[model samples]
Target: VLTGFASRYAEPESQTITIVKDNLKAVPARDFNLGIEYGAVYTIKRPDSWEIIYNGTIVNSLHEPVPVKNLTLYFEDFDEFVEIATIDTDENSNFYFNYTKYGNIEQNPLVRIMYKGDGLYNPLDHIEYGGIEMGADQNWWFYDEDGDGWPEWPFTLYDLFAALQIESSPTTSDLSVYLAWMAEFNENSGTSTFDIVSNLEGLLKGNTSWTSGRRDSGLLFDGDGIITPPQSTGFVKSVQYKELVFSTSDVTKSIALDVGTNISNTIPFVTIKENVGDDWDDIMVDVYFTDSPATVYAQRSTSGATITVSIFIVEFDDVKVKVQSGTFSNTGTFAEETISQINTSKAIPMAYYKASGGDDDWDASMVTTDFTDTTTIRMERHGSSGTMSGHYYVFEAQDSEFSVQKAVLSMSSSQGYDTASINSVNMSKSFIVSSYESDRANDDPEDGALDVFLNSATEVRAERHSETSYFNGFPTINVFVITFTGAESVQRGDFTWANSDTFKETDITAVDLGSSMIKSGNMYGIMQSDGTGSSDVKSAFVQHEFVDTDTIRLERYTNNEDGKGHWEVIEWELMSSSPAVYEDFDYLLWNDILDNVFGNTSNQFVVTSWIYPTALTSNQSSNNVKNVFFSKDGMIEIGINESGYLELFLSTDLVQTTARYGIEGLIQTNEFTYIAIRYNESDVDIFIDDFWYRSAVGSIGEPWSGSVNITSGGDLIIGAELIKYSSFTGKLDDIS
Candidate 1:
């Protein structure tokens, strides 16, 4: 028996135990128990044969040796894993063990090292010598029970050392050895693991090495899950610029380009500068793209002159641009003031044109400029004055979030009709396409007089009003398409003309930004008239403004209501810094703000928060009521009632009667709602998303008045109620 001075049990210094006689009985310790009842005993015999020595070092995911201190390791027989001997690792994580055996020695043994973990490092285990069979003739290394393309056991390890996806010069043996050395430390450390096999998948093959950027190294992702040479400077996802020259005597010609599949989110910008023709300034260029063949076409046109067009194609990711194409007539007078105002809103505008309209000054040099504001686009003829008209395209400033597609169509019929089909974007999203006459060799008005219609969400039909045949040939029209996504795109479709004047009324649901984003005088848009009749393509222009949170009213600048106007509205929310991401099922308890707001007798203040509720019905506690938002016991409470309506309950001391006050169906599920409650000396007003718009008018009962005395000393819980039985499920942000 051994007795400890400090701990209940202590290990003896000597490990070898020898017994000369066979008949012996082991007795348990009585009073001097020291808490240890039954102990494991291993029979180790000394042999006269060869000796085996094993030496190894414990390292972390970074491959740096970690000091495990005085950690113990076990060596056991392979079949039954019976413990043969035990050894401890030194401060440098190095361990050495040697054992000699005779004729009864096992062929292989298992060396098991387990780290219980400390404050700084996580627990890990390593098994050496023999391997473990998972099942179905599969070993531990290649086992993937979930079939997630990656080994399920090492998933936690991969997440912990994400930067070390595939080890340096990894082979079958190298990966198996390394994986056995570093177990699942990340999951044991209680760290969140990233799903490596989600939406966009890439297959990693042999010998590929990925470092964690710790040593200033970088990686490249080829769109189809392949990797390229490492870039020493930094990582760039996408950047490509290709310049191609197309020379032709024909007025309009297109050349195709084969861009590989390495590019994701294609935003192709096409620009043209003259290479051969003296009249290069008069040439207009357009481009088209297809997905299957991954082909891009660049088309150019010039009036009768043979031109070599240098087309520059720059591809970028996440760029927003809007195209507005139309026709502007110019007087032959030199420097004639031909002012046409285009409401480009907040977008930076750039305009381009090619001569049309069969005017004598078709060959003259003309340029369009925006002088005072982006709203007005002015064209001036620098050459000798002769009446002329030309088709123009005004592009909004470069935005990082717009998806754009460009194409050109040849107007075939003698009646001037053509259809441009765009497949690059989803028509269900807010989309717009504009078309203008280009590459007609002869500047004939019949070919240039264009009126475009939104035939369907994905198709735009163009028609020239004149019935006359083309003087030279059928002219080609250029179409520019842009689709809005996320918070940037406001709404789409045709405008509904109200009986009053030329005002078009439409309803739009936007992010409740807490402030009016698309207000009057700040709204800019492009309006195209979709005529009601076959031959009714009259001029339609409008100025738009926000009537309220749900309605937009567009008043016509020209009262000629010959056709309904189709519009695409865009708004840019420019913030100096990024906003906080919305959180789910989480809360922040603030006791500091209690004294400032609810201290005085007249508790008159407003509390606002943006919340997206997944469900208003309580499925958690026995109590049906779930305090959905804010609560202060015996003072004030705001929660979802049994009927799923937001109810504001006040203490009887303040309102003189205990009553539930709220609007009908104000707080809805699955919608981001900005809720605000205000209390003055007289009555409490509730606002949902809009400040000026009150929910009191939409209430089922009459408005309730309260006394000036309202006080609460409880802590302010931002997301959930005081007792957290039933909590909010969805996301919450910007609590004030």
Candidate 2:
């Protein structure tokens, strides 16, 4: 009987339905379920021009339709999913709603189509196909996380959607947790979303709480955490303090401090305060650092009575210190340490050279010892000749045991009637004898001798002189003895003239008197003549006739037959005097000494001098800049440009890979200016008048190598270069 009833009632038939309104077109409905309530699932075909609206503006759109299914048609509000029909798309890709006969329809009503997935779309995934007011306040916006054209609503039903997808009760009160859960849901699903939701639940339940304490206490949450003070706390990393006490008799006080660790690269802030007795005014205080284990000096005023000095150092490491008091300029010394202990090994083996006018060039001969023993080093200069001039030089081993030697000479002279000779001489070294003689009757005029051999290295004797007159008259002679040793050289002349008969205007000339060695000073000599008869006798006198750098003249007296004396022939003898021309810009060139001093090694050095620029050179070319000091081949130079700018250049090679620093208008005419240049590797610093002027970075070359033979091919030139015409036109002093 049931078979017959089934056969009599036909099976529910499926049908297709198409819905289109305005610009909205849905997928055709198919295979409608008739008997069961909410039986069929349906899908709406996405519009050909479907757009993603965000805050009243369309952010993105799909120009083509998409097949959608399992869509639940809802009425009115979004959360009220009272479905009048459940719709889905069939094989034709058309959506159909299963309409129950008792369902009611409202015209142009607000609706929200809810889509739940059947292996394709997840629940809570929905689209508003119609009834969305244009320009209305948007409660949701579309966000494309992966740029896939298909956008997801960022916060649309975000909490409910997250709960439904995660299948966990995550609190929605915390917006951060909710947003995090939404992100996890959209980007990752299944186990990933579940894990995120579980962690968020734990975070909400375990809430953050402040621990009941100060300083050492922190935040108490699911796990203990460190608490950092806010920026307003004004925290200090480290600090150091020191105090110095001084008595009425004390002129100065110092304190030593150890900053615990090396703070070489860090800048420290230092402050000092002084407190003297009420009767005394403010005292001066100075804070400084001294090497040899790196000590800090906190000094107090010397004049105040019972003063206290307070020193504060901040931003340094933990340190401890000691205080000391003493008189001014009498600060006690620190214990000496080896060079290596104080990181001064590089400064050892230091060399210095100084040169003045008329001094010999500095060379390897100046350095008596190697760097290993600085005490043995020495420097000496060949003494000046022909002039008493201001020329001196000093070279010694700094901070070492060394001494310099000087040469001293003792000399004497004698004279006779017609001959001259050196009587006796005592010298520290070998000596030379110079003599002059004149005989009128013998036809001998002024005569001079030089470089005569001494009897001994330290002492010399002159043979007794005897002169026979041609006319049976007494002879006359004169001699000069000059002894020299240890780099001392000088020139001297002695003259003797005699005549028996009255003579007139006889010209006498001296020869080979060592004129090149002459020095200007007083002249001394002797003159005598014989008388014919008692009535014919006359007084004898010597007259300085004329003088030059190399020669001098003396006129002798003669008696006439009437007993009247007159001037006779003048005698010309050689004398010493200074050379006429001495240039102010004259320079000294030390051949190839740079190579011996600074070889192809790396070095940090400073060059400093006080210069008075009296004049600028006529040459305006940059290449013709006046050189105050320089190394041959231009490896290092301190010069003035055409514009009177002081320039410094340090090169690795001859005119190659050089670093240059300069200051405009650094040199003022006729004014003394202090200039200094410090060079380390590729960095160059220029200072003028003790203030920083300019700097250059990079390209400072390697030190000149001794193998380059600067002594032969180049030189450390002062005032000018060997091949260049440029020369400094001013005075230079205290150059280092």
**Which pairs of residues collide in model 1?**
318-400, 319-402, 320-399, 320-402, 332-385, 332-386, 358-443
TM-score of each prediction: 0.26, 0.19
**Cα-based lDDT at residue 46, candidate 1:** 30
What is the per-residue lDDT of model 2 for residues 1-736, given as tens digits with 9 covering 90 to 100? 2575474555789999965321223321221111111111221112332222111111112323434555556543334445565555444444433222222223223344555433422343334423222111122212344554433322122222442353433453443342322112221112111223324211111122232211112122121112232222111223344556666666545655554523331122221212221111123233454455645453433354444444333321111111111111211111111122211111111111111222111110111111223222111212221111111111121221111221222122233212223333333222221222112222111111111223333333322223322123122211122322213233233343344432223333432322112111111111223333322112122233224433544333333311111111111122223322222334533445435334456345555555566676543213444544444555655677656566554455333333334445656766656566655554455666523543442343232322221212245654554343345655544343
C-alpha lDDT (0 to 100) for residue 690 of candidate 2: 28
Candidate 2 lDDT (Cα, 0 to 1): 0.32
**Backbone clashes per model, in order?**
7, 39
Candidate 2, backbone clash total: 39
In candidate 2, how many Å is residue 522 off?
78
lDDT of 1 at 621: 21
Instruction: List per-prediction Cα lDDT, in the order shown.
Output: 0.40, 0.32
lDDT of 1: 0.40
User: Per-residue alpha-carbon lDDT of model 1 for 1-736, expressed as tens digits?
Assistant: 4456544655769778864411111111111222112111111223344333445566665555665654445556446554445555567656655544455544334555566666666665555543221110111122334543223222122222432344422232334332312111112112121112221111222211231221222111111112233322211123333444444455545444444532232333332323222233224434444456555444433444333332222232223334444445556422222234433432322333444433332224223233244445544443433334443345553433445554455555454567877664555443444423233333332333344544566676655533343322344444445555544344555654432345567788753322223211001122333323212211233444455667766554222323344544334333222322222334334443344455546446555545566566552222233544555444555656444455565543345222344556766766666565666664676655422233343433324454675765466544454443334545443333
